[model samples]
Target: MYFDIAYYFRVLRHVWSLKQWPGKRGMLFRLLLVVPLVSAFHALCFLLDYVFFPRLWRQTVERPVFIIGHARSGTTLAHRLLAADGNQFSYFLYWELFFPSLLQKKLIRALGRLDALLGSPCLTRLQRWDDKTFGPTRHIHHMSLWNAEEDQFVMRAAFVTQQWALDVPMMDKIDLFHLDQMSDKKRRRWLHHYRECVKRQLLLNGGERTHLSKNPLMCGWVAALQETFPDARFVVMLRNPNECIPSTLRLLELSWKGRGWQPEQYRESLRVMTEISFESIRHPREVLAGHDQAVFVDYRKLVAEPRDTVHEVYAALGLTVSPSFDAYLRAQQDRERNHQSRFTYNIDDYAVSVDDIEGELSELFDEYQWPRLSRRSDLVKSVGP
Candidate 1:
């Protein structure tokens, strides 16, 4: 319900000033028409929720677990693993994030049930659309509307999401990453909206279940989140910067290209994102150093021995894995063994260099014992699950 009207107009003005391109018309349409219409509908639905679901006001977000890391650091795998314990955790499936209001979600669920009675034609079509829509980048990042996804999309309705950069290439203009540095008024407003979103989700899923969230951008939000949710628990995933940085840049590059943005249009934003990536690698550890409720996960170990790694995480978080969840973990072990990523990126494709990464993150490289490359050719390695 709290829209960032100022930021929305700023992006609109910037987009209006850009020269013509293939995606320009679509961007204009989304910014001028689609966003306002959808936001208005969501805002109305949000208001109606109180009338229809008054118990939503009493919902609480207690001891929510957040998974934070740099992109391509296995946060998804970890989130899905924990979310498998369905009775213990409640999360926002990709489609659910778009419909934040409890009323909207319930209505959709009802419609889904009705559709099922009618041979599930609507559900079947949605599945085909999901496959086609997410097919291109599935290798880079597996995504489906039904999968538990990043909760940051909950802020999309408020026009306060980092995902806008995927279509607009305005990372330099919009800074959703650094919540701690924001003015008190703006930061509190953003986090307050986010908390309300979480509360609605908790209400929809069942108030007794723990809320689970995974977002790479949350790396910059550790301090703000701690301040907001004093009882929050965190899982910080760490991977070699050499791998995550390039992989992240490559993803943005491909996304921007597909959206009709030329390299010249997004180069500066990409550079800005590179700087953020370094901080993403360093910030969470720095913030959560002595925090008792926080746990660090090594990417290599997470892929190599997921079950043991998750068990360690559960122990650290004071959670007991149920027998069924433990069996699910054991089953995932075999799947992990056969997993492979067809996605690969070269560090040299971007402006960053090996020396730059090593120099900027010498301490992380030393601490994590991540291997350094002797030749540029070694930089073109496959990114893993």
Candidate 2:
């Protein structure tokens, strides 16, 4: 409901200055027409929620769990695994993020129930559409409307999300990642709005379950989040920069290509993103070091021994794994053992090098014993998909 009018106009001007291409034109159209229209509609619905669901104001977000990490780290795996404990947590499903208003969500649920009663024709069609929309990137990052997803999309309508960089490649101009650097007034405004959204979700999910959120870009907001939710718990997912950096660059390159951006258009943005990736690894650990409520997860262990890793995480957070969730974890063991990533990446393809990564994060590399590539041929090999 809190539209970033200045940021929206700034992006609009930048997008308009670009030379016309099919992709640029499409983005221009969305920037000028589609986004504004949708934002207005969402704002209207958000206002109506106060009158229709007044109890939402009484809901409190207490002891929420936040999962933060660099992109393409094991954040998604950890989030989904914890989300499977549905009785203990409430999260934003991919589709629910699009409808942030409590009234709209309630209405959609009622309609979904009716659709189910009528043989699920609508649900089936939605699934087909979801597959078609996300199928191409499935290997890069598995996506589903029903799956618990990053909560950053809750701010998309407000034009405050990093997701726009995927379509516009304007990361050099946009500063969505640096909440800790923003003016105090602006930082508090955005976090207040975000907290309101979380409260709405908490109320929607029966008003008792702990709010669970996973956002890789939240690495920048560690301080702000702590200030906003003093009782919040954190899980920091870590992987070798040798692996995450290139994989993140590859994903961004593919997204920009799909959106019709040329290499020259996005090359600088990619460089900026690479630097941010390094900080994403360093910032959270430095800030949360020795903090009792924060736990760090190694990517290798998370993927190779998910159940054990999750058990350790639960113990660290003073949470008990329920019988049903324990059974779910046991069922996932064979699947985790057999899992493999279809996507592949080479570190040499990006602007940064292994030496640069190690030079900047030598402590992490040494602490985790992340293997180093000694030759160019080894660097070309997959780090871990």
Candidate 3:
């Protein structure tokens, strides 16, 4: 996202606050290259906003729909299903996270059109490369430049996000626990940058559609989000911690590999998992307690009964599921049935036991009567007397 020189400096200053480097010379060199490229883009965005699109800052955002939970809790799938109701949701793409300026987005679109007209395979090649890298984990989480992405990447532009910890080992310090203690002024600044990016996406979508974001990081920012968008609606996805934690660690390791950076081992992964699980359990309670518009969708229900789940989500949010949206959902479900995941796991993958996960998430599982690890098979069956 575009920001002023001052904001860029603030973010850089935070990056420099790291007292340790958790990578080799190669990762350090990559960061050197990234620094100047981002700096140039930042300056260019400043000029473009001031000279051409000053009105973007004035665009108002309405009741945005936030899809939030711990990572790998079906957030990507849920976001994909919801965004397919294109008439109702204005969304962010994976590439937009890197170039969030209005001018940059226009340039990307123009280049895409030119590539198509010239019969060039540049864009197709990139998508294929993404497929090759991400296809194996498609059942867990998927990524592409064109698909709806988590807002945490956009928040990374402000240099305050857990996503940053994946590559920049120094960023590991800013987990949910650390963020909860962030100064009020710094927290506000971070959220303001987040707002600026979301507003720009809304402007690009022509300003009428409701903005839909699938930012798992926002799970820890329920209080801040409430303060900013008092009318925003939330869809909190619920999955067993036994499954979510290891899969999340797998995703983080893959992210590091994709970026040519090194991934942290057991200790860091455990720290992230414990904190995210705690927040995943607690954040929904905070949101539902403070707002009348929040809804929780069980991951089991979503995977087993996609159609009914979507209907219930719409009803909870007081929105209608258009016929076209329903058709899209059914088609996707039919196609995926042929390729459903056989992937399974045990809590031992994360160097933790079932008792540990239960202890960490005791309140949530007990409150909801969620099935324990041994009985997770019942998730696929319909719940009835």
Poorest stretch of ten by lDDT in candidate 3: 376-385
lDDT per residue for candidate 3 within 195-305, as digits (tens), equals: 777887888878788999987777777777777787889999888766676666555655666755543433565566666667776766765774668888888778777
Q: After superposition, how far is residue 193 of candidate 2 from its true place, in Å?
A: 1.1
Tens digits of lDDT, candidate 2, 50-130: 889889768899999999999878899899999999999999999999888888899999999999999999999999999
Which of the numbered candidates is closest to the native, going by highest TM-score? 1
User: What does candidate 1's lDDT look like per residue over 1-385, in tens digits?
Assistant: 9999988988888788777766677788999999999999999999998889888878888999999999999999899999999999999999999898889899999999999999999999999999999987787778999999999899999999876778889999888899878888987898898999998998888789999999999999999999889999999999998898899899899889888788999999999999999999889989999999999999988888999999999999999999999999999998886788999888888999888998999998999999988786697989975
Q: For each candidate, give its TM-score against the true structure.
A: 0.98, 0.97, 0.83
**Largest lDDT belongs to which candidate?**
1
Score each candidate by Cα lDDT: 0.91, 0.88, 0.69
- Candidate 2 or 1, higher TM-score: 1
Q: List candidate 2 segments past 4 Å from native.
A: 381-385
Of the two candidates 2 and 3, the one with more favorable lDDT, higher being better, is 2
Cα RMSD (angstroms) for every candidate in the order listed: 1.2, 1.4, 4.7
Worst 10 residues of 1 by lDDT: 17-26
For model 2, what is the C-alpha lDDT against the true structure?
0.88
